[model samples]
Target: MGLTELLFVKMTGGNPILQGLLGGIVITLMNTFGALVVLVWHKPSERFLDASLGFAAGVMLTASFTSLILPGIERGGFIPTFIGIILGALALDLADHLIPHSHAVLGYEGLAQTRLRAVWLFIIAITIHNMPEGLAVGVGFGSGDLPNALKLMLAIGIQNIPEGLAVSVSALSAGLGAHFYACFVGVRAGLVEIPLALLGAWAVHIAQPILPYAMGFAAGAMLYVISDEIVPETHRKGHERWATFGTILGVMVMLYLDVALG
Candidate 1:
């Protein structure tokens, strides 16, 4: 009976806008699922975690540079791309300064409070970072570049697993509810993509000239995350070797995907 009802709901396709909305929701849910797996199951050593993060940083950085920023420049030329990158970096920097959080604290605090705060901060930062990625996915789909779109989506999705685990473990060490915290963190990280997708689609339609800038902006934002968030957090774990390994692994994985797909 329950299955029948669900099937009926699934079968009933609706308006175009509604379809897009549903697609966005599905994508968000998929991303969340990936994050949840990382959060609940994986218990990576500090060294491994740091290496994994370094790897993720490498993948994202490469993707931002080669896949997004360079392409935007090729399509839109240098001046616009430069402006976009600067604008994107500046926007995130401004947001970081304006948003109140405990990113400054390095040492230990009370376990529960510390973990809770860390979990929330990690979620917020990743959520912000995912927005542009989601936007890129949406733009790719909107532009009818289905192959590239899927590639980006898959890459980002796989990358988020390690990211989610990193956030979850940090929070857990800080003394948060493992499952609940993971779920919320995953949901928060994934949900931002919806608005990003919508906005990207709209921007592509309304200001075609700005697409290069937009891509550059996303690249810049991603670079900031690599520098400010991923690198620093990885260093905190003091696992330089694993981190380096992870970094190399991540780069290779992305490179393979780009070659196979792109």
Candidate 2:
């Protein structure tokens, strides 16, 4: 099958597991689409990247509460949800120390001068950052909440566009390859989400007890990424105004989606 066909095949929202897989594929495709934009722009403006990343940050920030934490508290109660949030944040914090994390602007953090090429390291770091997002989408589906899952998927997929473009531009800037191949790697980086999403759905399906915790955990992880990675990177550039504006716009869009869809 062609690349597009391969990725787009057999998406259904019937089974929660399948639905989770569908969510992963959808986000991946969105990222791919964004990366493809590099074909047109050749070199995306840093100001625009900062703004778009800011928008992504906003989406994840609001989504953490609107789609995850709030519903978690409603279903699982405050104590469990609160504890789950803390655990989630702690887990990501621990991961942050070992491997590097990446942003479009700031590049990799905590990366040592290892044998691994910076390009590979950058891809690995971005994949790590994306894991929680995949898990969040999966948990949303696993909760057996159709509307919530779909909304979560839509939000993530929408945000993935800019994220994907960022990866593509970064890869090209790193001289990873020609534009097509750079975007190819961008698609490859996002492929990590597929398996993680599946794992999330399976875990939630088998245990079911972890749904509330999963929700809280996913939300917490996303919030951590926002505070730790996205915000810092976006603000570091001289484009803080654009970043802030984009963030506010993203928040508004997500809130509207949550209200309109939920």
Candidate 2 lDDT over 69-188, as tens digits, reads 999999889888888899889888888777764445676666455677777777877887788999998898778776777788889999999998988998887778899999887888
* TM-scores vs. true structure, each candidate: 0.79, 0.91
lDDT of each: 0.64, 0.84
Per-residue CA lDDT of candidate 1, range 1-262, in tens?
2442244236533222232234355567666665566544656577766776788787887778766777788878999888988987888777666554333224322122433555566556566656666666555444334445455555665676666566656555656566676556656767887877666656654667877887788778778777776777777656767777787888888888877776
lDDT for model 1, on a 0 to 1 scale? 0.64
